[model samples]
Target chain A: AAFLVAPLQAADPLPSWNDGTTKQSIVDFVNKVTEEGSGDFVPVAERIAVFDNDGTLWSENPLPFQVIFAAAEIKRLLPEHPEWNDNAAVQAFIKSDVAALTANHNKGLLEVLALTHAGMSTDAYDQRVKDWLATAEHPRWKKPYSQCVYQPMIELLEYLRANDFQTWIVSGGGLSFMRVLSEQTYGIPPQQVIGSHGQATFEMKDGVPTLTKTLETVFVDDKAGKPAGIYQFIGRRPIAAFGNSDGDQAMLEYTTIDNPRPSFGMIIHHTDAEREYAYDAKPKSSGKLITALEAAPTHGWTVVDMKKDWETVLAE
Target chain B: AAFLVAPLQAADPLPSWNDGTTKQSIVDFVNKVTEEGSGDFVPVAERIAVFDNDGTLWSENPLPFQVIFAAAEIKRLLPEHPEWNDNAAVQAFIKSDVAALTANHNKGLLEVLALTHAGMSTDAYDQRVKDWLATAEHPRWKKPYSQCVYQPMIELLEYLRANDFQTWIVSGGGLSFMRVLSEQTYGIPPQQVIGSHGQATFEMKDGVPTLTKTLETVFVDDKAGKPAGIYQFIGRRPIAAFGNSDGDQAMLEYTTIDNPRPSFGMIIHHTDAEREYAYDAKPKSSGKLITALEAAPTHGWTVVDMKKDWETVLAE
Candidate 1:
């Protein structure tokens, strides 16, 4: 007599995702585009998936992490620079006056950025960001900010990579800032991260080459600029786009609309206040999801409700 | 029963390269950087190698291929617009008067490019380039322009790739034009090709997303700008750089000068007058190697003698 046993089933690629329509949709889309002989199959070279960094991949409740870092940098550097104390905008920022900080079309924000982000060598700036992330902890969780990345999204990134897709981070954050953490937190390398960029001058300083950041006109990578950035950097239209805010609306449209390949668009709806912060139209900083949320249904985008779709919040 | 057999020495990775110091240097550098226990070993992610496209990778004798394409386009589009007939620059270009076309800092050249390069959707421009390449032949070789690419360089690209190094093209050619042939000719993807970039606007035309190329301030990827382009696009500093002219001096410097990891720099001296063209200090178009050639020895940059080192010129 012989006993028959079924071969072990393949392990779940997205263990953090709940076994529901949302999870099934992601799996189905990957299978449709990746499996050989499928009608919707896309070649591996064209299999690009772009994700917005701030709210989609990580928590951005009170402020985007970069902004928080900037604020912290201001405090840390204030003692050495007494000239900043005379500026009213700097005083308002020090007092935590949100309205004052945002007033005058963010003149104060620009000033703060010029102070913290520019006037240093890029290597020095990279070191500063790395050091801050190593020490800085989220106020609410009391854990490193890098540890607050979404578990489901991280798994999704890995799953797409496993299927021979190139995962890219298209963010509104500073290119230098996002690149420092992206490879460690999301497995996305620096070359694959596209973000808002400013002018950097290259020169040889004392026989050593150096790149210094400058307070030049920054190319903002939000809203319609996202699509422009994509065209300039990637040189190919992505097959899938994921975002959680209005800033990413153009990118989503650019990804899915009239794409020759079968494409996908997903919106991460922060509906779980218990597990994570919830906001859509009115966010404390950065994300505002009204336009993208309203357009999602018409575009056939899957709206992922955090409460219903994700088994876990932060990456383990 | 065992028959004594020698393991077939792995097929020559760079077979088009002659058995000489130049070829051996490349193989030795790759081995030193890729071997597991070597002190100079670099991680695969950090092993970036950049190459110049025009003279370094292919034959840029009378003019760079893109300039030739532009000249062809001027003639092709001239009949459509009578106003262009009134323009002196257009007439000079049509007559192939090099001195007149280059007068006033290549004012005629710029005029030709504006008419041929801008005022179309990027998609339309891409299709036009593809159509031109498919039909156009090099006047010297009487073959498709793509076939003029150097065989030794192609093999070098493959050899580096086999060693897990990412090869990138940082050229002075138009970004979109270089991207069309880069993948098929060099086995490099569009994302890895960085070049001169013009502003493109994203908009919806007839409910279809479109990117219209504009005659704006183009960021030239030449001379000092090469390193800037690499910084903006690739983020990480390259470990190896290859070029054929003075325009690439900054990039060569940025790549090898005090790089954290072991680095290599090579300049291809155009000396094969019979097989290709031989002009360094006084080239007919684009590439001019004087300052870089003088500086190479002090920098320890290997200068390649094209006639002696390359067993084959054009890709077979």
Candidate 2:
């Protein structure tokens, strides 16, 4: 028993996490599900954990990273495509007017995405995203967008993987957009990243097969759509869910409520304006953490205060 | 070097496959990719192999197993819901009239699916499929549908998996239907099985979160749709693809043609009329292999003549 317990005690899987109730809760839940012969022990094959991307795993302050990427892409391509100059939505995007860009239910944002994301081979689109990620730096962090990921969240991901849990990203971000950086940034492979996707048409072009992305809208993986996406994509229920906004409310409910196996849910409360941008109830962009934050106590979900619970915010 | 060579010579990964050019080609491909310091050596993470279900992995002669399961479900539920009796499609299905069942481009079969597959919680649908698999037997084999898998194919699945290749099932079968048996029969997990799927609506029913299956076509993973489904589900292109009919032509092309790395394509020809139902130019149900079979020669894809290449057909 001493030999068995010593290794777990010595190794701090969540080194970035402060020695507080939040860290203990994660460890306790993992131990309960992984301990052999325990009443709550889940089989290795059933240990699925899902995470939301934008504000939960990384910073989403001024705007969601993909929106910024889309805007920059339009700017980069404007010289070649002069027709876009006359479009109001394109103009709104270029002017950095968030109100106009997101008004009328993200009409401008969708237009920006169509110009940048559609009518290209999937491979070509992937390269464009990768190039943007490599070159683009967060305005405030002064780090590459990929490096804006939370150090504490990265530790948790690794810890869960160490316990043989299959981690997946269920986000509202574009599927192709997240896939380019998923493996390198989060250790989650492309297949494990489920998000909003556009219709793709398969064709043999110039003696080579190609899947061209189209502007046709598919399911958006957020809120209630998260659970539906999980069913269609993951095929089974996840026992653990994590998020930072109201967009993940249905996902958390799906993971924890009435689950046959013991489940865990956690909310990442952006409470440290000094270390990270703090916004809730009225955020700057994208993430609105009102309903989920209110429901956290009733559902017995862990509310992680980033200012107090994290010893480190971002990687050095 | 002698000790290392001894195990390689001693083990036969494909015992059910006869020692011939077909088997040799498979071994050669595996060796080329797995050997270290070789030009064709692909990293383990990039080695993804996709397989078609039905005629490729198991028997689909009298009908696709899913169609048969749907018919059986209709009969089982007919007594409780007498309203189904007045329906012509339901009557044709119950009477075992294939002509009427598949007439008007499978209009009747679609009705059968609506009655059996939709209007239930996804969890309940999964249970129904499992129960049907448990009770239903192959008409000729007299074995459970789950046990009707091909022995040689199963061995091939194991061999690829042993070599650090991630195996996935990209089939035209229902997603929820195949997921119930994929892991148990093929050792492929639920998330790894990509197939035709129905739209599901997520809601809280009596305070319990549920995703109910809806009679809406989300996607049909067949023909050109195969490559599209792969783009949406798997993200990256697979290094290898396996299938038996024309439905997989697009998938095979997507896997092998112009891939930057060494790739493989194989077709399982149902030439053994005695052991398995043989149909290529025309199949009774879904699989029709004319174009793909003719194209195989041009593409240099291995064509496995089932009667000549396989030493074993179904599991004993």
Candidate 3:
């Protein structure tokens, strides 16, 4: 089919991925899928694979970057929400004191998410996310967060999709949040994003069907929840999985576990501190790629080195 | 520009939708968008139009037909859910007694939805919907429910897309349920279907991010809620709106009210009782099309007589 040939062209849709083991691995997978009569010619149904957003597809430096965006959004939204002036969590967010946020990062971040994301309908949340993405820049890179996406991984995504693989981003980030930018940045549509969600009620408000968010949390697609999110969102077990941190370990393990045919799992190791912040197995910010690294040989998982494998970092 | 032409010639994309009005509407829209001089030329960002599923795109004869499919699915799923044997609502669904269901349809349907759709994660619900859709045949039509799709409307959808309009299904049915067959039947991808949804909690059951359904309702995309759903899901007001009943009037009004350029608001009035079951003002099943008819002149909504507009009914 003509569709099969589109992915076979060696010229990378994202040339910035460069050429090395990571790029070669991506090319080999495409070849296997597109080449007829090859032992690895995966049926289209089983060809669907999913990846994580933050650390897997791009760099998440200076903090889980979405948090920064959320914090900024919360501040921008503060005027509309005057109650935040009295609320301790909202005050900390508006102040932009990392110490105050890190003092209770988990709860404080949740508070920020609640304040910014909750109360409004899901549609409002999506619009806010889109609006923020249009202007929001990475704190350190000072570029639009969309540009912060990894060049090699972006190539891999388009390459896989070109070869008849349907790729999805199964992330712990909020579904509405990721959906706002996934199609533009990753080529994955909103339906392809499976992630954390907030509580919603189906109601007719002034004759409009609205999905209003509640303070209550629905599902958080992180850590061990990655694999479950994949199953819940995609239904079929993914033939391949990609991630960069311990949060993605369960997803990796789930993908490579005893399938009838060959399955793939790859981890993006942060080795280039100059180009991007690199950390693994540290006390507070350890991305926990070490455990997956040690298990790779036994589990048949592919561990990718950012410094050694990728020729380029970010797509221009 | 090359990218736009590739998908069109790749396959006989809309073999079913080849009629005149439907086909020309699409061509005109696409010409406007792709060409420079057309006043209705929409930028890619704003080139979005949403449609309702069920009666709008396909035959909804057997009572919002998806509900009928769900009823059968409940029967098949009964062994897994033994509680149905003792539960009154479940028993009514299992026994297939409309009289019993009518007595308590709202609560009964809600109860059935809860039991049938609950406990399992979102993915499971999607799979169940898909499985039922694949095999289940409509009662009176005795054809695959997917085949029940309107041939002319399908043409309209394809024509609009050829012009660069991104079409979406804003339905009152469950999002996951409609998503199962939408891509194959309507060519509108799963992400494009915005409909009623239930609350789902993200939980790690055996190390996966599983979205378990809570006994809570999310947004219901029907009636005046159509506009809200379009704004929420698609992020823009539609240039064109197509629907069958009064449930879609708000969407039409919302689309046509105060638009800067030319827009279309269409209503598919079920007037062919001989060819297809026709009822405009039925007390029970009309779904409020009367108000739309009365307001059509004021709203400038085009009332489409199913008997007149469609040259063909179902996709052969």
Candidate 4:
């Protein structure tokens, strides 16, 4: 029986997954897919799966890491934007006052994004993001943003890829931000990232055709937006979707909306207060969507309790 | 001698390469990188190399195929825009008259792109492009657009990947268009594609955060724009660059510029009149840029005579 279960357990790429229902659930699904005669044999084309970055694959606590990067970039860029120094958002951002910036986080975040990401070609913004990611360390973790990725999730991604599932990162974070690290951390290439994007323009600068950033907004891959982003980016309903907050509810909902084969949706509830903060149903920042949470049982979605389910958090 | 040559050739992944200065140059570079004792052994992080898609990896004959796709999409969409019936550019596009569209090709292409790609979110646009590529047959080849890929280039892509080189397609064509079939045709996932784009917006529609297209111009990756696109998308300069015609000249120039190890630049000159049309320095559409062609010799760019160098063409 142990030998038989070995094959079943080994089906999960993350074999070291803590012995919990979350791990068991994943193992069962893999068994179903790998079983020669199982009804859930997914075709190669439909085997594509997409996950939200930030809160989904790793911790977005203490603020989305990319947001912090943007804030820093905005401060650096403030010298150029002399008028911005007087601007309320820019001033708050320059001061590094998290309270002020998060007072109206939505507007503040967008302002920071615009300031840091604007005035350059899409290519320039991308380069800036890459340059920043190469050196920037997370405030709490003191690790390179790339190094802050969750070990269990990273294993899950590799495991999925080994099983012929093409994984992608669809996040609300800036596309450029995610593109910088997706290839190295998640093994998902830059092209596989779909996220919020600012407008870019084609212009002749010094007699060269360049893509310049415009003051126009493109897609913002965020809450209630995940399904739409998936529809746009992947062009298919993901057979499997994993997310960690209410922002991911729609993606989960969209994934479970009746497909031919067995579909799986899992939510990582941040229940580990010691390793990571545990807060849900809060008024601000990754607030849990009560409706989706309540309906998880009926919808066949697995609600993962991080404290109980994950034996380890960050990858060494 | 045969035994020694076989081992040496086998060591190089691109073995079909001609035994000449060009072949030796490639072999020398690969040997330096793969040989443990060599000083040029680059770790995986620095091994990132990007490629230009259109004429570099594949043929862009009979005009950029993506432009043709846009034309077809625009014709299909024209019925909905009665205003376009009287519009000269749209009228020209509807009749499938290349001359009319080319008379003002930039604006005309923009019009077609705007109409075909606008109003939909970036996600929706990608889906439309994918659907079109699946069913739409190439005008001349009469095969699915995805099947029109160049065989030699496909092998080259796989060959590079086998050696742990990450290949990307940076084209002047729309990102969405190439992304549709890139994975199937070139093994390049959609995320590795960087191309021309249209404007998009972030909005909450029907209780979902979505990216909607606006009738605004974004970046057009062409000419000097190639380097910028590669920098923005891949954040690294390519060690090897391949292209045909002048549109790819900037990319070739950019790739071969001041790299540490041996860098390569190759141009596929269209000389096969029978297998494919051969016209350089002609006033026709897809006319090659003369300055880049003239500068090739001085720049150490290997000019490949398609008729002579290639054993096969198209992915048949």
Candidate 5:
């Protein structure tokens, strides 16, 4: 004589995602990997999922948010150095012309960053970045930049974590810049962040231990650098990866195509002009989703069309 | 009326640690922070503890184990390049005189590492290290180096983790070298390890993504570099720090001294010659405990006397 035992109700794993194949694929992949005694079941320790920061998690549109922050930094420092205007790139950025900076394929952006972000102790620079993030707002959204993070992806990050995946942010964004808001915004702590970085020399200035930030490019984590960064930091190939652009193509290829595990790759396509912005293989889009968009079919990557796949773009 | 119930039995947290102030202090600190409705309670997420690898967690003498691995690597690579014998350092290392290498104060050791360990893909190097560990045995103990791990510290790590503290290893050892065995040896995964690293370039080899190791010295996580490495990798300041040498002094200072938390710093003093090799404040010792030995008392740091505090050293 056995009494019927009621099972605990499972909440929506991804509350913001619409009922579609993109969401269903993600759910199926997670289920297959997590089910104990199943053929595709992966141990919890190997359940690693990496995410590209700029476009995948938040709006990198208009431009990647760090670019805007660097431009603003240039504007802030412009009053001290009148000679900065003589530089064509600096002048172009100050005038609010995104194409002038983007025209050089991020060379101008790197130059702007070098001019504004180096030559200070990491602590001092941390304070400055903290100050900027406190007041910085997106131009089109008219809200704080942190608030512009996609609500659907936030749910996804939590969902992956709930499924025993150690979620990480593998970004092309400056390590210092993203570290400021990563923990608070995405629930991914700083230790879990792997990104592009500038060189810093460890020295004792006035007998006080300090890490002096230098203007040297040590690692630029984009395109091919993504896989390298992952190996250097995580030391294991991720079981899953998510990104939105060709810059993330190397990471996606490394994750889904190479690893022996039952892995997942995803690309968030900005196909909703009214909700977000629709730009793929276009001239003006910051996150140019071209190679990844074209290769998604062959790799079994889930391409999430923002308009149809996301029930909510941003949290109210 | 309520029936009286016996309190749940508490498991002994440090079975390897003898009943003394050293063991008592650890229990007191953990209790203060974890006690519910207590004034000193710290949230579980902020409970970070960092341990220096070599002497703190395992044996560093007769030498730090990684250096032994590197010397062995030099010998293995000698057959490929006959001309390397011309170099005084390589010739000295081949002779197996630890004094010949240590006399140069890590400069010669670094040369040995760059010559033998670099120029291969990280994956290849990882496999080589893995292969070496599988066959290699400690010279003095006649056991695998992985078996030399301190039993008391293992208990401490488990005790901390059970209480929600995330433990990390900020070692002066080679990053790739330590990662091969960290998960199996210490229960700390590769991603939790922050150590010295050399530069590597990312390139596709016949359409396969590979990271080619280079000879360039990118970072050395020692002395002041420990704090800097912690900052670069973890981003957040740890609340608990442990070490056994002067090399870890800065990390302890950065973690316990600077951060505004109820932090703890403990130094593992090598004073047991009967059960284990004991050498601190000596010229020949690689993990020097001189400066840190003197600074411990002033910082309210706990000094674990190996002979007195531990009932056993290695795991049974």
Candidate 6:
């Protein structure tokens, strides 16, 4: 909340952003909304910007990072869960059998998620996640997951924050998982990272109090859940929303297609096969860009073609 | 984020806090954590201070302010729910029958809470709550609930913020309810307010999306739930915590009883019956200074006796 008095630099806040309408729109909107005495000028407190984590801020290609982490964690914990030896899916995961995991993907994924995340004290689980992140790398890129963030988007986060907007991450991924990396990667603090959460129980362990996670999903923040999560976590509607998938459709609608206030919503079109993976109209059950993409034109949402608009992708 | 650089005022930030050991302890703790080269220096990101809302920040006497609002909300919505006429507790509530409402308090209170809070879209409920707050007054004080906040605690909140600490409210009140008033009443924003929450469902109503409240307690942020809720909402452990009740015991213990960083846990002893209301060791379930009170001396918590420690109660 404290910023030293410094003159605004002539240098662009979003250096990674290419010279395009996609970037121009953001700069123009921010300038318009922040100009004092202008009709569009918003108070500092109401300048909330929400960004979806999975693809909007970083790459979620191949599979969501949390899913990847869950699979790896299942492999690591397989030695402890000896009873799962009879299960084909568990064996497939342990053996890195993608075919079997895909065959029983739902069942397999559920076991991995439940076994790896639940049943531990939150403090212990945080340490486990921290340990995992220190060593975990993306399957295709082989880079640390933390460094997989989009440089352009990272610039955007700093730019918005510098202009007095509090940037938040609204994701369908586990809240616990996203919180661990939000501050480190995005400069968005843990409190501002609202996502799906599971039920937790409080108990005393040897005279010390601790909260243990349960397998039950308390909230699944996706699709419509995005807006719901935003509403729950932040009473004020975000004036700016960014996302890359159909999961963020409602949030974008809630932001730009709103009844009141000047708002902006943008979708990062993952259309670069060279720099990054490209797939928007994905298979069944994927939050394919069909609905959101189709409606983007009328809502005035900026759909950034990654191949054309981005000068660079990864932070590196 | 936009505050002009000014020299730190030599005047005390907490003028309402009388010169005493309790006030000095708070000052010392903050200085130790914030001074750059100090052994206990905590980074600005780790300077999180949590406060229990009801009695800690304001007066919760005569009934928690939320319960009072719920009772009033029940009266306002009774016309729509004409069947409530058959309920004696509802009738007593309507006629101000303290005996009847108190006798069947649990069931009656549940009905009031469910009828008033559940079944409405969060936006509509927020509006309803806002409207009620715009007009409602504390039954005893005959003043707005927002105006009843403690002057000393308000100073403490601002003081901590000025010292580079992020302040959060961890309350047992409805998250939605507290959020509606938090920003307006306290400097804390809705995102910084963590409290008990009810289950809500995301749905589309007439082509517009809305999150509807459900009649289920997802998490109750009292007692053990305090620490659990803190861990859920704010993954970082709080370095400083303040409360006025036994319900806050677990949180105080979690924050300051035993931890790595230099932490401070302080309790506001409501021992000024003349100025406010004095009732410690409150019957079985109140925020009676019992478990927390007993543990404070050994844990080095600063217990503030309102009559002696505060120059004034409500901010003038």
Best by DockQ: 2
How many clashes in candidate 1? 0
Q: Is the docking of candidate 3 incorrect, acceptable, medium or high quality?
A: incorrect
Q: Write the per-residue lDDT of candidate 2 for residues A152-176, one digit (tens) a residue.
A: 9999999999999999999999999
Q: By TM-score, rank the candidates, best first.
A: 1, 2, 6, 5, 3, 4
Residue pairs with backbone overlap in model 5 = none
Best of the two (1, 3) by lDDT:
1
| lDDT (C-alpha) at residue B150 in model 3 | 80
For candidate 2, lDDT tens digit of each residue in B239-291? 99999999999999999999999999999999999989788987887688999
Model 6 stretches astray by more than 4 angstroms: A1-9, A95-105, A283-287, B1-9, B95-105, B283-286
Query: How far off is residue A6 in model 6, in Å?
Result: 17
Model 1 TM-score on chain A: 0.96
lDDT tens per residue, model 4, A35-118:
666677877667777788876787776777877787778767767778886788877776666677767646776777677777
C-alpha lDDT of all candidate models, in order: 0.89, 0.92, 0.72, 0.70, 0.85, 0.83
Q: What is the lDDT of candidate 6?
A: 0.83
- CAPRI level of candidate 5: acceptable
Which DockQ values do the candidates obtain, in the order shown?
A: 0.68, 0.77, 0.10, 0.11, 0.45, 0.48
True contacts kept of 4: 0.03
Q: What's the C-alpha lDDT at position A68 in model 6?
A: 72
Off by over 4 Å in 2: A1-9, B1-9
Native contact fraction (fnat) of model 5: 0.43
Per-candidate TM equals 0.97, 0.97, 0.77, 0.76, 0.93, 0.93
Each prediction's fraction of true contacts recovered: 0.50, 0.76, 0.03, 0.03, 0.43, 0.47
Residue pairs that clash (backbone atoms under 3 angstroms), model 2: none
